[model samples]
Target chain A: EPEVTQTPSHQVTQMGQEVILRCVPISNHLYFYWYRQILGQKVEFLVSFYNNEISEKSEIFDDQFSVERPDGSNFTLKIRSTKLEDSAMYFCATRGQGRETQYFGPGTRLLVL
Target chain B: GESVGLHLPTLSVQEGDNSIINCAYSNSASDYFIWYKQESGKGPQFIIDIRSNMDKRQGQRVTVLLNKTVKHLSLQIAATQPGDSAVYFCAENIGTGGSYIPTFGRGTSLIVHP
Candidate 1:
């Protein structure tokens, strides 16, 4: 089974520092998404990307957050000026074209100190 | 916390027993629904999904039942094992024209004991 893979399984950064969480979606998947879950909270959608641009984003996806398909296989999420509340388990997911079964990665645990 | 389902519901079962986790969705327009499992320090793993058009779908050791009339969904795991101890979530969304931005339900913790 082709699965989504994320780099830097765990990251710790100081507040106000910038951080990039990297992910490589399934080789043939077309739609990519980013979601975060604070400890003991439900997973929340951050943004969705398709066709090399953002398709939609939630209110939590503010100016401090940005996503990019920097290459043919790499999708990245950059958080600028992180805050303590930014700490969460970030997940990257992808689905095939016209398919609703989205596969998720193992996630990167981001801790903003 | 005046946000959402502040406390997730929890279920405790013994090994070799069947586990049924239930969820009630708040959406009437949701056309697609999915069940995902999340272990202690990882992303959610897709377990199964059922469309509003269908009432039941079965997978390996797992079966999902959807009751659109009452807006309810349940996951039945057969012969639950200790490794099945994890949190399970039911998510719903209006799946039309290839959009999968789902509104997830508050997760339910399943503690399978030996």
Candidate 2:
């Protein structure tokens, strides 16, 4: 089965640094999403992308966060001026058109020191 | 704010036994629900899903039952094996009109002992 893939399984950065997480969604998928899971907390939605524009975003997705399709297959999330609280597991997910099921990737563990 | 939540934080079952995990949603507008399994250090994996229009759906050795009247959903794993041990989460789609944003529950930990 085809699955979403993410690069840099683990990312480490110092405070005030910029980090970009990359994802390659399923070839035929049309909708993409990004979520984060803080240790011992529930997974929270960050943003959703469709048609090269942001469709929806939660309050947690603030000015420091941005997402881009960059290419036909690559989706990226950039966080500028990371804070210590930014440490968490960032997950990339995608779903095909007409499907509500969003399949998730293994996740990129971001550690902001 | 509306959210999806699990009834229990953990459940333990003997190997070959059946396991059931429950979730509750406070959003009445949610029309789609999904169950996902997450092992330690891994992302959530899709298990099964049931739409609001359906009361029950089965897949492989798993069954999902939805009670829209009470906004309750449950996942039943038959003949649970040790490999089935993981944290199970139930997510509800709170968006409409072609936008689907899933609110994930806190997750229930299922431990299967062989």
Candidate 3:
């Protein structure tokens, strides 16, 4: 029953400000992912991380976004310059090796004003 | 672009009734599929999953049926309770021999009335 945990359940920031969202994945999980859900829209994949580097990223994951597993346990997503369109719910997910199922965290709601 | 999509936006059912949510996928390369439930403000929670090699899989009171020939998948919940009310999404993953990314559908909201 181990689950991924994210800090700052809700955050509000001004446009052009830098914001960092943190996530602590399951101890034994090997793959980590970040996804965002805009209000009334489908969940969109942002990036996937493995082996301490980015494995893949979507077009939406542009220069403004970056992910890091700095301490092997804390996975974080940083947005350098937030825009109004960046307001959405960011979710962190992780899956163990050889497992296809990804477990999602409660999510950190980010609102760029 | 290939995507996973739901057939309906919302479904209403009475308590104790059975509920069925449907999904469709446009990607033929997808080999893995999953069903997730998302309550109002939370992230998606894994409910059940079925591989392309299997046609049907059951878990607790839920059953997932996959029809690869028609690119269709459905989740059936037996004796649905009020607590079962949530937004359900079906996602498809295309394995690339390395890491796989999941494409999520718009989700179907299930409302169970007691």
DockQ of each: 0.76, 0.84, 0.88
TM-score versus the correct structure, for each prediction: 0.94, 0.98, 0.98
Residue A46's lDDT within candidate 3 is: 96
Best by DockQ: 3
Residue lDDT tens for model 3, B82-106: 9999999999997465677789999
What is the Cα root-mean-square deviation between model 1 and the actual structure? 2.3
With candidate 3 superimposed using the best TM-score fit, by how many Å does residue B2's alpha carbon deviate from the native?
1.4
Ranking by lDDT: 3, 2, 1
Question: Tens-digit lDDT track for model 2 on B1-114?
Answer: 888999999999999999999999989889899999999988899999999999999999999999999999999999999999999999998875587888999999999999
- Give the range where candidate 1 chain B is weakest over 10 consecutive residues by summed lDDT: B1-10
The Cα error of candidate 3 at residue A39, in Å, is 0.6
Q: Which structure among the candidates has the greatest TM-score?
A: 3
Runs of candidate 1 exceeding 4 Å displacement: B1-8, B95-97
Q: Identify the superior model by TM-score, candidate 1 or candidate 3.
A: 3
**TM accuracy, model 3:** 0.98
Error of 2 at B27 (Å): 0.9
* Rank list by TM-score: 3, 2, 1
What is the clash tally of candidate 1?
0
Q: What is the lDDT, from 0 to 100, of the residue B8 in candidate 3?
A: 95
